[model samples]
Target: MHSYGQFCGLAKGLDVIGDRWTLLIVRELLIRGPCRYTDLCTGLPGIPTNLLADRLRDMEREGLVRREMTPAPTPAAVYALTPRGEALETVIAALGRWAAPLLANPHKDDVFLPHWLVLPARLYLIDRSPRQAPVRVEVRDGDHRVTLEAARGRVSARVGPAEKPDTVIIGQTPIAWQLLLGKIDLAQARKAGLEIQGKTTALKRFGVRPPTKAVFISP
Candidate 1:
């Protein structure tokens, strides 16, 4: 890690977390609290094992993460963000907003996860939504179910289902990403085999307008 050698808060912060996979590791930990080493590896596809180990060591030394041994369902160790690390949520959220435009043009090497949509959904979609109910969303073929709760000018996501959802979106990770980015309309996707249960109008509060259905009459 290279440091600016200057006296600045941003520089100091970057000195600790400016590496390639560091923030992403933090992001995963934030999204899914207290992850086992294997869980982090599974969530972050394509990371080298040795590099992950090195990063964990560095983060622990920087007071950004801690390693804990638990005795539940068997003995195991897990890594969780420290208080200082938890404060990075806003930074990650801001990055998600800034990076929203890039999602429209995905790169071949770019990976997608259903839970990743939650950040932008919290920023761009739910924050603007007029409705303030907790919505449970299911991402088909993955373990990325999350409930989005809109409250006080912003929305936040929690892993797992909401007690009662006004709407539920069922689709693959790619489709979910597009929907959150506003690149594709849910109604159109639904017509093309995407599955959704619940009222379409319920999403209007989130700035989602299902495409107008087209009807054809043939003689």
Candidate 2:
């Protein structure tokens, strides 16, 4: 790891995680939990095999990652984050929040993986109607799909179709994100080619309210 040669906390933290694909490796581990080497490769397309091995080794050496063997029958090695590594969740989450605006103007060649939506879903979705019963909102983008279930004042997201979705949203992933962020209403989303079915009220439960104006008091 290359050091910034500074004694500051930020510089010290960067010294451990600032290498190319380091944080992304952390992201995969955070999203998928303990994963086989092959699983990591699958999530991170276009990464070279040797480079991944090298990064994992560096992470292990830095005490940020550890490898463990699963129980017999079909035993395999999996990589997981150490407690120290898990602490980076806030840093990764903050970066995700910071990048939300950039999604609006994606480059033509950008790769849109549906699984990446999980982070934003957790970040943005909140159960406005927490007192009400649970609601399942299924989102689809081509073959990729994810379900957002709101219940008991918390919203949880998972990949795959909901068994019995209360509301279904079919459209481009980006458009769905815009809707979830409350940047566009249902009517505008329909005009943009999204199809909404079932209880429209289900979505409102995960409401994103407009920021309230601050009152200025006279001095």
Summing lDDT over every window of 10 consecutive residues in candidate 1, give the lowest-scoring window: 210-219
Query: Residue-wise lDDT of candidate 1 within 54-73, one digit each (tens)?
Result: 99999999999999988877
Q: How high a TM-score does candidate 2 get? A: 0.83
The superposed Cα distance between candidate 1 and the true structure at residue 57, in angstroms, equals 0.6
lDDT of 1 at 9: 94
Residue pairs in clash, model 1? none
Of candidate 2, the 10-residue stretch with the lowest lDDT total is 210-219
Predicted structure with the largest TM-score when compared to the true one? 2
Instruction: Give TM per candidate.
Output: 0.80, 0.83
Residue ranges of candidate 1 with Cα displaced over 4 Å: 127-135, 151-153, 180-183, 208-219
lDDT score for residue 71 of model 1: 81
Clashing pairs in 2: none
Candidate that scores best on lDDT: 2
